[model samples]
Target: MSRTAEEIGRTELGPRPLPPLGEQRVASDLSTVDTVLSNGLRVIAVHQPAVPMVELRLKIPFAGTDPMHAARAEVLAATLLTGTDRRDRIAVDTELALVGSDLDATVDPERLSISGNALASGFDTVLDVLADALTGAAHRAEEVNRERDRLVERITVARSQPGTIAREALQRHRYGDHPFTREMPQASDVATVTADEVRALHRASVLPRGSVLVVVGDIDLDRALAQIESAMAGWSAEASAVELPALPEVVGGDLLLVPRPGAVQSQLRMSAQAIPRTDPRYPALQLANLAFGGFFSSRLVENIREAKGYTYHARSSLEFTPSGATLLLDTDTASAVTAGALLEIRYELGRLGLAPPNESEVDTVRQYAIGSLLIATSSQTGLASQLAALAPLGLGVDWLTEHPARLAAVTTEEIAEAALEFFAPARFTGVIVGDADQLSALRGLGGVLMP
Candidate 1:
C-alpha cells in the first residue's frame, strides 16, 4: 500500500510547542561546612559522596603582581607542579596521567592557587605529590628563563588584542597609583628576576599558615583533615598578611580615552570603586546591579543593545574582592555610536537612582541573581573557588546560604542607594580604542587622549 500524505507529514514534523523560558531544576543548595585544622589552615570540606572524584584547592596570599621586590613567589607557584624533590617534572606529569587526575597552579595578583581533581581513592597520592612540589621543588634557572620568555610572548599577544588592551587600560585608569595598576610581569622584567627571588617569595608566602585547603568529594571531614595533615607535614612557613594598599577611592571626572587607530569597533569601559566583599550592602548591590546591566535583560542591555541594537553584547558587574568592590560596565560598538553608547550607559546609571524599578522588574532581576548564584556553585571547582576566594576576605560560610533571603528582601530604596553609591555617572574613567579620527568625536563627550 502507498504511504499516506498524513503519515509522511506526521513523521516529518511533530507538533511545535514553545520551549520553557528557563531551567527546570534549580541548582542544589550550597554545601554546608565548618572546620579549621590544628595548624591554622581553614578547612571547608563539602562532602559530595555521590561523585567519586574529589577537588582540592590550596590558596595562599601570593601572586606575581603582588611583590615589587621580586617575582620569586609567582615563579615558584607556577613551577610547583613542574618538578619536586622526589619527582622530576616529567615524572610528576606521568603520575598525574596515571591517576587520571589534573593539576593546575597559578599566581594571581593577590593569591597563589593550586587546584586539582583526582579519584577519591587517589587523594593521598595526589596530595603527597603536591606537597612535595610545594615544599622542595627546585626553580631551575633554565625553566625560569623559558617561562619568562613565554610570559613576554603572552603579554605581547595580549597587547595586540583590542579587548585585552581595553582591560589593561581600564585597570590602569581605575587603579592610578595603586598596586592594582601593576599587571603581570613583562618579558624583560621576568628575565631580570633571579631564581633567589622566586625562592624567597615561596618561603615567605606559600606556607601552611597563610593557606587554606578546601576539599570536596567523597571524603569525610576526618579523612580529609588526616590526609591533608599527613601530606603537608613538611610544609611550614611564617604567617604574613598579603601586603596590599587600600584601593584608592575612584576620583570621579577623570576620563581616559585610549585611541585604537583604524579600528571598526570601539571598546567602552566604565568602572568605579565601591564596597568591599564583607560590606553588608554587597548582597543588595549585587541584585541592584543585576537590574542595571549585570544580566542580559538588564536596563543597560534592554536600552542600548536590545531596544536600540547599538552593539552585539553589553553587561555590567559589581566585582567583589578582598581589597574592595568595583562597578564595571563594558561594551563594544561601532565608532559612530560609541559616544551615544556611553551616553546611554550614563543615562542608565542615573535612571537606576532616579527611579525605582517596577515590582516585576525588581522581582525578575532578584530571581535571576539568586538563581544564577545557585547554578554557578553546582560544580565542585566552582564552589571550591568561591569559598576559597571568600575565606581570606572573612566572608562567612553562611554568605551563600543566606544570599537568597538577602536578595529576596532587598528594597527598592536599597537598590537605588547601591546604584548611587557605586555608579558615578559624572565621574567615569573612559577608554575607547579606535582610529584617532574616530576618537576626536569623543572629545566633545569629555575625555583626555593618550598617545
Candidate 2:
C-alpha cells in the first residue's frame, strides 16, 4: 500500500542516532597555486598533469554603474571575438577549428571573463591569440554598431516575456536606484553608447591590478607563467574602483503585485537577508536551507508541491557573493490560489522556528547536503573556479573539504535556532505578477499591497 503524505510526516523511526561530526579535511590533491606575472599582469596557474587541455579565465571589471553600462559591456565582450589587428574573425575561427579549440568571452557584475579550451599541443597559439584580442583588438565602429543592434533586439524580446518582467519588477522593488538591480540594457540606452566609451572602459578596467588570471591544465607552472607573461608583458595596471553602497533592508509586511494580463499561474518570489559566505553559521544554515527549501525533497516541496499540488516546485537558498548575501524563496501557483499558498508558506516558516526537525529528517538532509558538496568538488574545472572565487572572498583552501563535517555537526536544535533568527514572519517580502483584481484579494490576508 502507498503511504499517504500524512503517514510519511508522522512516521518517525525513533531513536536513530547520528554519527559524531569529524574534523575538517584539507584537500591536499589540489596543486599549489601562486600569484605573480611579467610586465604588470597577475596570474594564478594550476598544473594538472592528467588533463591535456587548458582553461584561462580573465576578469575585466569596467562595464557599468547603470543599466546603460550593462548593455555596453555585452557589446564590448562580443566585439572582442569579431577580430584583432593580426586576424579577422573568420581567420581566427579557422585556426580554432583546426585545433579543435574553443574561445569565448562573457561579462558579469564585476568583470569580463575570457576563457579558452584547446589541445595541449596548441595551447601556446591559443594563448597568443587570446592575449592579442585582449590587449590590441580593434573595436571597429561597424562591429560595435552591429552588436548594439543585436543587443537591442534581445532586450525587446526579453521584456515581453512574463518571467523577465516579474524579475525586473522585483529588482526595482528590492534595490531602488542601485546598480545591482540592473538586469538588462534598454534599446535607447544601447543606441546612445559610443564606441569611444567602450574603448575607454576596456583600457581602464581590464588590467592587472584588478584582474585575476586562472590557468588550469597539464603543463609546467614555470613555462605556463612564462608563456602568459611574454604575451601580457606590455599591459599595465590601471586605476579601477567599485564602491557598492550597502543595500537597504528589503521592506517587509507588503505584497508587491505586478499584474500580468491573461496569465494562468502566478509566480511568487519572497526573500530576506542571510549570513554571508564568511559567516561561521554558513554550514549549519546551508543544511537548514536545504531541509527547508534548497532541494527537491525539501520541506517546501513536501508541504506545498508534492502533498498539496499547489505548484510544480518550491525552493529557497542563500545567494552568496563577496559583498553580501540574501535568502530567497520562490514558487509558482494558480493566480486565484496564490493567497492560500502564501499563507501556508508563512505557516511553515513559523512552524520551522518552533519545532526542531526529528532525527531522520536531519540525517537525510545532512546526507544530501554532503553529497551535493562532494559532487561539486569532483570536477577539476569546477573545483578550480570555486577555489578561485572563494579565495577572493577570504575563504580558506580547506573550506570545501571541511564543509561536510561542519554540516554533520549541526543539530536539529541549532537549525531551529537559526530558523528563528533567519526567517522573520514580520520582515518577509512578497512579489506577485498576475491579474490586478486577483492580487487585490491577497490584501484580505493581512498586509499592505505595493504596486
Among these predicted structures, which one has the highest TM-score?
1
Candidate 2 achieves a global lDDT of: 0.73
Give residue 136's error in model 1 in angstroms: 0.8
Clash pairs, candidate 1, are 72-197, 72-198, 253-427, 260-434
The digit string of per-residue lDDT tens for model 2 on 288-331 reads 78878889988888988988889987899887643677788888
lDDT of 1 by residue, 206-276 (tens): 66665677887877767777778787777764575374556777666656777777898988888777777
RMSD of each: 4.1, 5.3
Candidate 1 achieves a global lDDT of 0.73
Instruction: Please list the C-alpha lDDT of all candidates, in the order they appear.
Output: 0.73, 0.73
List candidate 1 stretches off by more than 4 Å. 1-33, 63-74, 447-451
